[model samples]
Target: MGRVLSVNAREFEEWMQRSLAACEAALDGFVPIDAPVGLGVAMRYAVLDGGKRLRPLLVLATCEAVDGDREAAMRAACAVELIHAYSLVHDDMPCMDDDVLRRGKPTVHVQFGEAQAMLAGDAMQALAFDVLTPDSGVAPALQARLCALLARSAGHAGMAGGQAIDLASVGLSLDEATLRDMHRRKTGVLLQASVMMGAACAETPARATAALAEYGAALGLAFQVVDDILDVTQDSEVLGKTAGKDQDANKPTYVSLMGLEPARALAQELRCQAQQALADSGLPNTAWLSMLADMVVERDN
Candidate 1:
């Protein structure tokens, strides 16, 4: 994989196109027949909004890295994306960030009313759990494990909790440890879960899973740090969301704690640290793991 992050390359372009196509196919019959037409439309928009498909891709990649049947991981892959889409939809709501744009298009709330947007997010979340339940050749035990891990990562104790901290910390001076805690739960858990789900199919050793989880933790935090830096340096067009959104929201960030230059440096350090974790865990011989770490820093948008 060589860890390249730009989308203009031929191989990456092909992968993204195929992934998005698969994602759309998985969403077929997603519309609820009795739901109001406006609400159904909102649901589709939220689930189908264009993105890098990074979470699902991570699932597929990690499954392959650990010698599992990559195809068997398909449903799990889509499940991750569905949950991610649901989170983005809710995050953009007026009750949340109130973001006006997502992936360069009007946010669900901007196109559909707030009530419809909320229903769409709820629907998307339901669909995510439904996808994971399908018999995709995943063992019953592994499926059950995946369900528990993903739920823990998504519900009140994980991403939801992290989001709560973020909302509460707005305009408040927070120490770095507190900020990291908020991000690790809110963002890192999902990333960790994605990798673990893939590894579960492989039935890798406990040590391997722990190693990958360490890598996941470092990369997830690095991803967030870079995002904060990009908000300070990039524009809305390139970012696809409103840039400086953290600042406008008066949210404390890595950039706020340290200078932009230092934040960038920290992200780079974390990326390297993540790669080292993979190596220390004996997965370093794998190119894709290291490549993903590099992409965390080199991604342009």
Candidate 2:
């Protein structure tokens, strides 16, 4: 079984490399290397050549797993990434998390000035919808659904709302349930949407869709749990960002709230839940998703 898992992992890694290459090309084309002026440069800077691109990978992988339209999936993948990038651009501003390093480089607000970063984030959000609701290619109904899902995930009831909770909870005691709820909005919702959006690219059945949603939710929570663990265990250089920043900011995290060992256990449990969801998904050959679950937990950065 270990040998079989290794072989499967190798195959999925190859697939992920190819998909990442394709995603890079697509993102480059959508968010051009050049724009009209300074704002254009900032937009490109915030998005191009940074970060893990995990969300986009989820989109494409789920698309393939569901036998969806590759072209449409690529579009959705890039769109979701744009939203992620925008959030980071804004999140690093002085008003928000106020960080200087991201993806091992200067944060957008630091690199491009706060105003430019803000504008770039705004533009990127608009561009996400533009990419989704193109004049041709993807079906109109599907486009609408994708647009709606992205909006909800990125809007008040999702990532934005979670951020609000995070800002408010700093220096305040939060119960496990409240912390979990906050992460479900801030991080998990978008991740969940990535899977659902990919499923939407094809004619997935209701059962497969539900199972994928479960997998995505578990994976999302696991991602945050690992992030919290890395915040304590890894250094700034290894993490490509400020390590222990969460603790410094007085922000509540899995590690801070539940302790390091328990947080680690929670991540493993979430990983198991994610894998179980995939098994129950009844979808054929979810090797990529399974590998991604492990990668999210095992990654140091």
Residue 8 displacement in candidate 2 (angstroms): 2.6
Candidate 2 residue spans exceeding 4 A from truth: 1-7
lDDT per residue, candidate 2, 222-245, as tens digits?
A: 999899999999999999999999
lDDT by residue for model 1 over 1-301, one digit each (tens)?
1332233446545655676677567665543535677767777777664777777767776776788766557777888887888899899998989999999899998898888888888988887777777665666777787788788889898889999999999999888999899988888889878887778777687877888888888988988888888898999999999999999989999999988988989988998778777776655334555666677778877
TM-score of 2: 0.97
Candidate 2 colliding pairs: none
- Which candidate achieves the best TM-score against the true structure? 2
- lDDT for model 2, on a 0 to 1 scale? 0.90
Q: What's the TM-score of each model vs. the native?
A: 0.90, 0.97
Clash totals for all candidate models: 1, 0
Question: What TM-score does candidate 1 get on C-alpha atoms?
Answer: 0.90
> What is each predicted model's overall lDDT from 0 to 1?
0.79, 0.90
